[model samples]
Target: MSDNNEYQGRIVVITGASSGFGRGTALELAKRGASVVLAARSPEALTELAQECETAGGRAMAVPTDVSDRNAVAALTDKAVARFGRIDVWINGAGVAAVGRFDQVPLEDHEQVIRTDLLGVTYGSHHAMSHFRARGKGTLINIASALGKIPTPLYASYVASKFGVVGLGDALRQELGEEKITDIRVCTVMPMAHETEFFEHAGNYTGKKAVPIPPTYDPKTTIDELVRLVVEPEDEVITGWQGGPFSFLHRLMPKAIEKLMAGNTNAVQMGESMPAPKTSGIIHQPSKA
Candidate 1:
């Protein structure tokens, strides 16, 4: 059976298409017969993904793009539209996360994440809306995180960015409804670190590093569920139990939730310096020490 209804021949644009869930979801959508638009800053990775999609008997294209650039994003939309004549779906998967304590984290750290995670969605969805307004149908999918709802310790910037995404998606859903734009759907995909390469590149505070929780808790096993929802349709989905508690406890008991997470210095790591993500966002590379 097809994983999509009315998705055959549809054009789907995915940002951060080089690795992780972006890459995985792009290929899977191709397998489902959706024409995929693979996007990212890394040309080599996207080029390889394109070839793989083709080898799978699916039509695909690798467009090297930095979603933080409005011009680049518009070009991305233009290319997708030029290739397929219209866009059926837009997925903003490009994001960066920093794991560290609040004080140790630099203010400049999150600008990149906000650009790619929050503003990238703004650009993609804005462009998608213009296209959908003309065509009368389309969907905007932003890959948020479970922390979008519950703020996390180590990933303050990441959580803030994702929280913006969740708020953006929810608000846009309302804005589109008010405008009578019934065909456009705005949603978010919330997932933890799957088996993707993001972990290696995940930015962290110089203050500390934390132990690995469970790899199974990551994306590989749960990614299918995320892809399934984007293919089908949904409001918002909580993917795992690591995520389940926050929503439940936060709602039923906010004070208790904060108390539980209070002063949990688990994520703080003291150090000289660590690697910052280069291929992910538009932030300047940290000075080489």
Candidate 2:
């Protein structure tokens, strides 16, 4: 449990708030008395989530946004600030994945994944940092994946995007430190495969069902970690029981860890899952699911 007082009067802007970690974190923050500004591609879903957040005992606003578009993201920031005066924390959690061999997946799919996952974070960070600098203090959290640290075979584009996110966070921290910006904080979260709508919404060309890698943890664990970050922002955090150990092993023995990850991805995401036809998934559009 968290100290509810910690979040009292705080304002948070969360992208991808329609589902998964973003939704869960919003509810948790709402319970803790933080105002939440929800952004997602689905207006209906965002409206419903906003109502739920208010019901959870916090202020709420819904802003339908597609983070990939720079203009849209800019408008989202403007709307959040307009609604809440200023944002105390900003979470860039919007992302998409395309699953298949690098060559097999459509070129457009790969581009879309990069645009949504990596570029989306970039845009959010840019706007958030600008606001934080002017406000004199704020926290920016980027949701990355364990694949950012350790490469897997199937999710090539996703791994690339996450790696970019990790690097981007590091660069931002370095810049902030050089500028003597002590109050503004940048944190990147890396988590192993968890139970979320991610798998179901992933574009698949592998002719097999999209499923999480083995040892998928519960979404609550990731949500708890996100909430913790809000209270005590750190530079980089690896969530889940397996995340730390795997990251450590990868650093110590890159080749061996890569081999193991490849085998695991093959066994679970490819071999173990049922056959399914190719689908564009939510990469091209919002999922009706």
Candidate 3:
């Protein structure tokens, strides 16, 4: 649990602030007196969120950005700095997933996932690290997934991207330590399938609607953990009770875990009813949602 007023006057930058965990985190932090910089592809949604933050008793700014574009991401950083002077916390919460059999999913769709989920994170970390190094104290939070450590079937590209994210966060942590930058913290968060807008925005080619696997946790489970890190920094955190057991099982019996995922692929990958047409979602274009 975090102390009351722990986030007061902190400057937090959150991507994917239009909805889901990013939106929740921004509101919760704002209520605690943190100024939040909201970034996403939807300007209208971001603006509305910023107003909501202000109503909660903290300052806020909205910068419409597509994380996949390095220039746009750079511009976003500039806007945040211009508005708040400095960023205390940077959370890479923007992500898109595609679900279908690996061979059946479009090649371009697979690449889109890599660009947004993996390279987008690279871009955020690159800019945030430069700023944090200059400031000498800051937190970089990379939102990975439980799938990063334990791969699941039918989400090949998403699994690949998240695996890369996990590796990137660890590598960055070590580099910071080697340079004796102990004041700057690099934290990675891995959560099991949770209730979020992820399924709605995800690209799909599975001929069925996308849905979170059973035992889905609430979005607050992840958001609360994110808020806690603002006060007590850590190297890595696996949110949600289910995620803890999944990580443990993966360590004890990797092969068995893989087999279990394979068996559960159908339920994890698609809904029973028919789905909308194949779409690349917001990966190739800005999200209107």
Candidate 4:
């Protein structure tokens, strides 16, 4: 049987909905007939996205939010419940990155990256778990990265944050199983670097244009897998054709993979042209794509 109509009238909450994977997934889910709650730091962008989703023949609400702030995230949950009664699925996709030598990146920028990427997921999981436990059913979808499983240079803090997300999801899933909570679900999606506004919004100390290291995948590929997970939940999904192989190799040949990744650090640092002077990018604020 087709699962296309399964999401009809279901309520979903997505962070980082203003742009990138979050935005793309929101639109696709809307088209699939899900009621979407869009949360991001950009109110204007969120409002515009909500209109698009409505035009796609689904209900949507925009809530400007800073996930780094626990209170703001809590309020986001409150507003979603107030508007849609209950959240059937929550996608914690809001994130920012800093691309540069670890020491060269500003201290504040590193801290902000952790706060937004790691702590943000922590907050979302906390609230979503509470609601799901009370209702005894819900899905938590955390958008992590392939980098989480295999470390890379020039993205130290980003690696740390994603690693935390992976750990958090595994722990949550294990606990739920231990408690025999069969209905509720926790899933983590790990995708290879994709074409997203992340490079543009990322804080750069590299002085060169930022691009995915190599073997970049399409954003749609990741989005489609995420949408599919809405109906078919898994403990963890590593998307992209190459993602699984790379992860496996990293496990079998940890030293070899580390050496190759270290060699590629120079490629990530050297781009076509010098990038603009360093700014905090979207770590501390919002940037429209």
- TM-scores, all models, native as reference: 0.85, 0.98, 0.96, 0.97
Relative to the true structure, candidate 1 reaches a TM of: 0.85
**Once superposed on the true structure, which residue ranges of model 2 sit more than 4 Å away at CA?**
none
**Model 2 — TM-score against the truth?**
0.98
Per-residue lDDT tens digits of candidate 2, residues 55-126?
999999999999999999999999988878999999999999999989999999999999999999999999
Across 77-123, the per-residue lDDT of candidate 1 in tens digits comes to 89988888988888888877666665666667667767777888889
For model 1, the stretches where C-alpha displacement exceeds 4 angstroms are 1-6, 207-218, 262-289
Q: Which stretches of candidate 4 lie over 4 Å from their true place?
A: 271-275
Q: Which model is ahead, 3 or 4, in terms of lDDT?
A: 4
Greater TM-score among 1 and 3 belongs to 3
Highest lDDT scorer: 2
Task: Show the lowest summed lDDT stretch of 10 residues, model 3.
Answer: 267-276
Native-to-model Cα distance after best TM-score fit, residue 22 in candidate 4, in Å: 0.4
lDDT of 3 at 93: 93
C-alpha lDDT of candidate 3 relative to the true structure: 0.88
Write the candidate numbers in order of decreasing TM-score.
2, 4, 3, 1
- The candidate with the higher lDDT, 1 or 3, is 3
- How far does residue 269 in candidate 4 sit from its true spot (Å)? 2.4
The residue ranges of model 3 lying beyond 4 angstroms of the native Cα positions read 267-276
